[model samples]
Target: MVIIEAKGLTKDYGNLRAVDHVDFQIKKGECFGFLGPNGAGKTTIMRMFYSLVVPTGGYIKIFGMDLNRHASYIKSRLGILPQDNNLDLELTTLKNLIVYARYFGISSSKSKRKAEELLEYVGLTEKAHVNIRNLSGGMQRALLLARALINDPEILILDEPTTGLDPHSRLNVWNKLNELKEKNTTLILTTHYMEEAERLCDRVAIMDRGKIVAIDTPENLMGIYGGNLEDVYLKLTGKKLKEENNVENNKS
Candidate 1:
């Protein structure tokens, strides 16, 4: 039931090693989370899994198929909701979903029907005809989620899926994600938000400085550190006061 298996995965940018010797496995129908602070190489590792960026070294297997050997076949059954919204602004909310569906070879009629159902699911049915430019930030995020699900992908990769939304919108997204998990979709997500990871992930890998520092269930991780996840994170990756002082002095 392993949907994703990565071993010795590494990625480099010139002399900088962004992701180094990481290994993990995600089970089918499980919610897996990558939790890290800024510049922790979380996104770099995610890009490798999605095959957007080829790995400098190691192997990535998605659904028992090698990513390099079956990139097209793997991508066909995968969905990605990146940190940035890539919706075409000129199109209406519904049109945006329809266009993405076509990329998966979904027919126009079927795409339209799927789009309508998705819009309703995301509570944006009334804004179906509204241009993307006019939708609120939360609405756009919801639309992006719905669009990612249009093709009924077996695995969904989400990068900071609810980064800038209000509490209600965040909760709505959490609910939808839980619904998807209940339907047996494998989910892989990256987030700096400790609470979100705790609520959504069955297992989490904590990365820092191009390495995985810890991996376990949120509760177990917290128990090991004798504190909440946030405290544990700070303890493991403490900031250097001297470095902060030097940066402040340089700015002045």
Candidate 2:
């Protein structure tokens, strides 16, 4: 049930390599995590998979189709919740959903019905008519989640899905993600939060300096590294502050 296969994937930005030759596979109905600190190129790799950014080299296949040749078809079955909120501030919560559904070619009436169901699913039914500007950050996150589901995609790609939320809101989002997993939805998530990755991912790939340094289950990674996921992450990545200071000193 391998839904995604990436072989020797690489991306370069001028002289800088954002994603170095990397390889990975994600199976159907599994929660896979990409973990790393800033500038690790996790997002760059994920963006390549989604076809937002073309790979500098190598191949990517989704659902048995070549990513480069069938990007539109692949995108049709993929749901993405990017790190930043891209919602239209002037639109109502329901309107946002309706607009997204149209991209999938769903009829207006059908899209409206689906939007309502999604709003209810995300506990935003009460705020269906509320403008995006008025909703709390948590509510907005929930709305994004709901919008991602409007097309009923088989694969969900979330980038820092719960970033910048309160504890309760984060929990709510996590619960919803779990529910989706129960329904056999395959998920690929990128996050800096070790706890979130540990809690949600069946397997995590730790990337650093544009390459994958480790890939294993949370428990195994922690066990092998002699501590929790955070400790393992730090051990693998070293201290970011020191790296930053070194760069600063080099400049001086």
Candidate 3:
């Protein structure tokens, strides 16, 4: 089953087009990746999927329903981990999860139980009672991930899901996400980490200047371009050494 279908998807900010004539289809249980530099409109495409921003022109269908008509239902089935750290700092880790779970109408008892399980799953059980302020950057990202999964939605839209994590922490989250994939969850991801996409995504779309420049399985993309993802990116989009260094710096 095709979980998502988009054609001619476009988004504009005044004179600048943030996403231009994008098109893609994601299978029900496959991992689809969106890769690009900062401000390449990857986030804009993601926001469109979750109906956070209305598109200027396009057609989208989620779960066989029109995006325009079924946005509420579609959003209800989406789990989103935005790039920004938007966790409620005033609340404890457990409270943070429980409160967000309430948005999906989960019962208090069930939310608490699921919160406990996720805290354990994300390796944050020991810090569940701690305030968000005291947690490390990586721990907070993990908690946000756990919060995104509290409802067990059919689709997960992850934006740089491992952005703030150490190598060990990032690996742990990767394993958990792979487990979810094994259970047939559709995932849409946006990230600057080519290796992460290569490891996790069944296929990826490369975007530049609000447009999709390429789309294929990671291996095929490499083969067609005669190099690795970074090479392909550089060839197609023209990599800047400073930008490359910045990505490396942030990943560490």
Candidate 4:
């Protein structure tokens, strides 16, 4: 049932090593999360999972199949939502999903049906014909989510899935994610939101500077570290003050 296995996974951009020899395993149907400060290689690892980046060392296997040999098969079963919005501005909300579904070789008729179903599921039926640029931030986020699920993927890979949404919108997305997990879909998510990670992830791996510094269930990790997930994370990574600086810089 080990759905994801990373053995000394490493990625480097010239002399700048983004992901070091990191190792982790994720079980089938488990909500596994990756947490880290900005530029901590969380994105690099995420990109590697979806074959966006070639690694400098080590290897990964998904569903017991070596990623190098079976990337197409592995990707066929994946649903990905990147941290940044990448919707087609020229396409209507429904069309976005329809086009993405076509990449999976879904029949045109089935793709249209799937698009309509997902649009309604995300509560965007009214705006299904709206241009992507005209939708509100929250609405667009929901649409992006709907697009990810259009293919009915077995493994959902979400990077900052609920970022930039209001509390209401965030909760809605959270509920949808919970429903997906209930149906036994394996999820891998990366987020700066500790609360989201604690709420959704059965286990989380805290990465710092291209390496996994800690990995455990939220409760067990908190128990072992004698604090909340954020506190435990700060203690292990020793980046509380640095993170604060980064936040301040972003605001300014």
Candidate 2 lDDT tens digits, 212-245 = 9899999999999877777887788785423543
Candidate 1 per-residue lDDT, tens place, 164-196, comes to: 899999999999999999999999999888889
Question: Candidate 1 has what TM-score?
Answer: 0.93
Superposed on all Cα atoms, model 1 deviates from the true structure by an RMSD in Å of 3.5
lDDT of 4 by residue, 1-252 (tens): 898899988888989999989999999999999987777788888888878988899998888888878898888888988888999999999899999998889999999999999999999999989999999988888898898898788999999888779999999999999999999999999987888999999999988888999899999999998778889888897777247536945985
TM-score of 2: 0.94
Model 3: how far residue 98 lies from native, Å: 0.9
Off by over 4 Å in 3: 240-252
lDDT of each: 0.89, 0.89, 0.89, 0.88
Q: Flag the better candidate by lDDT, 1 or 2.
A: 2
Residue 100 lDDT in candidate 1: 95
Clashing pairs in 2: none
The alpha-carbon RMSD values of the candidates against the true structure, listed in the order shown, are: 3.5, 3.4, 2.3, 1.7
Pairs of colliding residues, candidate 1: none
Q: Candidate 3 on 36-71: residue-level lDDT in tens? A: 877789888888887788899897788988877888
Candidate 2 segments exceeding 4 Å error: 240-252
